[model samples]
Each structure stands twice: as structure tokens, then as C-alpha cells.
Target: MTRPIAYPSGSWPPRMPADLAAAYCGEASVDVFLRQVKAGSYPQPVVKQGRRQIWAKADLDRAIQPTPDHDIAADVALDL
Candidate 1:
């Protein structure tokens, strides 16, 4: 059996799957998250602890931000 660590360090960031799921479109679906991970759509994992992926919360949050130009272009295409 193995004991759990609280990840009391800045380097650790947030590695919980729930946090990752939330950062990924506010959905808690691990299946979709894993697919995105494989598709290289999510932020790169900062660290690999055993079999766990340590995702930087800031970086993960950044992935969801849409560029202004992309949104404007979409609006233009839609004539909105």
C-alpha cells in the first residue's frame, strides 16, 4: 500500500483529475479528457509522478482561452 501526499509545493501545481476536468471545459468526463490529452489539445504535463500526470493549473487554464482574432473571424464568417 502507498500513502498519499498533499503536494505542498509550487512545483506540484494541481494534479488532481477533477481539477484537470474542470479546467477542460468545466466537464468531469475523464474519457473526454484523456482523448484530448492524446490529441495534444491540453497543456503538456509538467511532471510525471509514478503514473500520474502533474498539470500546471495556470497552463491548463490558459488552454481554454480563445484568441480574440479567432473569435472575430468566426463572427465575421457568421455575419454576426
Candidate 2:
């Protein structure tokens, strides 16, 4: 018999998908998020367990912070 894996509280599971629409503005998709990382527009996520990529909540918060010259609408569109 195989034992099930367990996760600690507040940690995203390895290979788990983010709730992007709920967590991001303008209904961003996971692919868009990955694209943003590839484009150097956002912080790169760490690979968990040498197999999965997980985004830190802090990094996402930093990416969403308002800036004077930033266009929120454009960012949303690009990520959607």
C-alpha cells in the first residue's frame, strides 16, 4: 500500500495549479503568469521538490503593487 503525501498549512502543493482568476486581476490565466515570468516582468518562482514551480505570495504582491508609470489595464490584458 502507498501512503498519501501531506502538506503543511499555507504551502501550495507541488504540481498544484494556482487559482489565478481569484488571485489575480482581470482573470489572468496560468499560462499568462508563466509568460510573465518568462518575459522578466515578474519574479521567478522557486522549484519545489525539484519538480514543481510555486509562486511566493510576496512576489505576487510585489508584482501587483501600483506604480505611477505602470498601466494596470495593460498588465491585466497581457496576463488575461
Candidate 3:
């Protein structure tokens, strides 16, 4: 298993774990998150410090929220 990324509070550079990508994107796969980022379907994470990729928890929360055009009924059907 891959190790989780850790970020210190008030740290200049922030890093997020692959699991966070799964939680944010509703898909437990880092590859999927990377694909979404490449496709512009998801918000890009900020790169702070030297090479750390940081995603704000608030930003991730907003990104995961259902949009106005989301088809709730369709999602429910798909879940079944």
C-alpha cells in the first residue's frame, strides 16, 4: 500500500495523499484523479514550496458537492 501524504499546519507547501484524491473524486484510485485533473474535469491542486501538491480541504469539499445540473435520480439508479 502507498503511504499517505502529510501536511503541517501553516506549512508553506502542502501535500495530499492519494487516498484524498479517491475521497474527493468519489473514486478510490489515484489514476482516476490524475486523469480527471488532466481532462480538466476537476480543479487543479496548488503547488506550494518546491514540488508539493496541496489541496485545501475546503476546496475539495466544494468540488465534491453536487452541482445544480447533477441528476440525482440518475445517480440513485446507478448506485443500484
Task: Give the candidate number with the greatest lDDT.
Answer: 3
- The CA-based lDDT of model 3 is what? 0.60
* lDDT at residue 7 of model 1 (Cα atoms): 28
Candidate No. with top TM-score: 3
lDDT of 2 by residue, 4-52 (tens): 3333367443333344321342224556655667787766765445645
Model 3 C-alpha RMSD vs. true structure (Å) is 5.8
Candidate 2 residue spans exceeding 4 A from truth: 1-22, 25-27, 73-80
Q: Stretches of candidate 3 above 4 Å error?
A: 1-15, 48-51
Error of 2 at 13 (Å): 11
Tens digit of lDDT per residue, candidate 3, span 1-80? Answer: 44443334553323365456545556546666766777876667765556555666556667768898998788678757
What's the TM-score of each model vs. the native? Answer: 0.53, 0.52, 0.59
Q: What would the per-residue lDDT of candidate 1 be over residues 1-80, giving only the tens digit for each residue?
A: 32222323444335554344443444335555656777877766777667776676777768767776557566457644
Worst 10 residues of 3 by lDDT: 5-14
Which prediction has more favorable TM-score, 1 or 3?
3
Model 1, position 28, has a per-residue lDDT of 39
The true-versus-predicted C-alpha distance at residue 17 of model 3, in Å, is 3.0
